[model samples]
Target chain A: MARLTLDRTRQQALSVSVATGAYGISFGALSVAAGLDVWQTCALSLLVFSGGSQFAFVGVIGAGGGAGAAVATSAFLGLRNGFYGVGLAPVLRPMRGWRKAWAAQVTIDESTAVALAQPAEDLPARRAGFWWTGVGVFVAWNAITLLGALLGSRIGDPADWGLDAAAAAAFLALVWPRLAHRRARAVAAASSLLALALTPVAPPGVPVLAAALVAIAAGWGHPRPEEVPE
Target chain B: MSAYAWMWVAIVAAGVLSWATKHAGHSVPESWLENPRVHRIAAFVTVALLSALVAVQTFASGRSLVVDARVAALAVAAVLLWRRAPFIVVVVAAAGVAAGLRALGWG
Candidate 1:
């Protein structure tokens, strides 16, 4: 039974990694269209290694926002990765020094989700799930990103190839799973409207930052039962 | 600095900041992250940011808000997502719809 469970965990991790990694093509194409050269685009994947932050960075820069705004936007999008690290530390305990640092680097949404979904007492399975998903996604995401950047550069006007629309779709796909609760839905609606309103008045990065305030306001109050329906 | 130089800085800075944020969580006290308020805010912030990106990417073109091929493409993408299509399929469909619309000069 122990061996059977381990195999199941590995299977889950590999599937999740492939599904998540496939999205890297869109990121690569979008980043290149946003005006990063192929090498810079690949570098973003290698170093930053967060899909949402990398996309937001390109989105801000592609829209002509200053470097400060781009960095700020990307950084804000990266906050959840930190939270993931906190959540995973206990499950994958005994990590120290280089191992701890490496674990932190791989502590992303998929890894956290997969790790936490394992049977609570099954530390070995949880660790396997986390490492497999994290490393698998890292390799697949970077390799696919490079391919997309190469194709994106040769594709001429991004709009002509529909890459811009694909970027929006990618964002929508990401947030869709998270919008299970009423409060989240309300926040998403308000944030999008505020962002739309500010798009014309404020600079590119400012609107997204402003939209974040809606969430902060919604969340600052004491947590209610309905706050976390998931 | 030239735009090229600035971009390189932004890329490196963003990467460093990302790693720092991820690392901080591991080092911070568990109680700090366990706070319900912090958790709620983080969850909501993610939804808000992604939704905002979708709106901006689909509707905004520089200082002006324009309706173009992207809108139609996103509409199609939404249906595919609603029906539970795979991620890559949804993306490819959106791109195809937009490309088709632009080719026909209807967007």
Candidate 2:
């Protein structure tokens, strides 16, 4: 484990939080496109706090999917956070009952990513990364979402300014760093192609899940050294 | 139901479901967490699902996939990210490129 200084972890947390938080600006604008009021958009960021699910929720609604479909899509997107919780449980198990519940509420992609990005054995830095990134993103995400929603109607067509593209760009930026290896890149490209293929035939949000199946299939059937990081 | 009523219902349901996943994660045993299959699938899911998101957002509009300036902006963002640019720069750059192309009537 590299002796990661607290300062470095804090820097990483702040930077990721800011970047991920800025994503809320576009979300606010897009939610308006989806027919959500500013308060509704703000509430989603504040209460839901999960980026993938929030995006899926609004995207589904924006496309005229019913509320049931929107909820289902968001729920599916949120399942990853559960997986993240499993990974973090041993590390964060010190909390019990309500504190544990609260911790779980904030256990989204950014915090988990920062925590996991640290060298495996550096417990202190990893913990610092989790909490700092979680709180930082929460604060920044809500604030920026409000700003974006307020600006949404005035922006005329959000697509004209590419705010409609903001959510995709944000998620892509987050996924970009993980593509450092060849196999990960392959998985990404393959999965993207799968999603693209499914887009025309599948219902809303179904493509993303079908794409996840590609990874699961590869993982269970063909276990290669590069494909399975240890 | 009114749209507002359905909206609240969806929010509450999604919130409960989201919290359940996270809370359930905390209760899983360490042995299960360390399984090779689980680990590998988790990794794959991260890459694959997020990529799907990018694809969906970049090209998929409503029910169809459409190419537009957003794709070019995503390409620019990917290039900047590959170059190890800061996170904010990459995001801002993508939006700027997309907006620029639109302003030029090419979007």
State the DockQ of every prediction: 0.48, 0.55
lDDT scores of the candidates, listed in order? 0.77, 0.77
Residue-level lDDT of model 1, residues B1-107, one tens digit each, is 89888888988999899889989877876676577766666556656766777898898987689999999999998899889886567777888999899999977
Q: In model 1, where do residues sit more than 4 Å from their true spots? A: A1-44, A50-141, A144-159, B1-14, B25-28, B80-89
Regions more than 4 Å wrong, model 2: A1-42, A51-70, A86-95, A112-129, A145-152, A155-170, A221-227, B1-10, B86-88
lDDT of 1 by residue, A28-58 (tens): 8999888889989998998888887898899
TM-scores, all candidates, are 0.64, 0.76
Each model's Cα RMSD: 6.0, 4.0
Cα lDDT for residue B18, model 1?
89
Tens digit per residue, CA lDDT, model 2, A51-87: 8789889998999999998888888878767767765
Candidate 1: give the clashing pairs: none
Q: Which ten residues in a row have the lowest lDDT in candidate 2 chain A?
A: A221-230
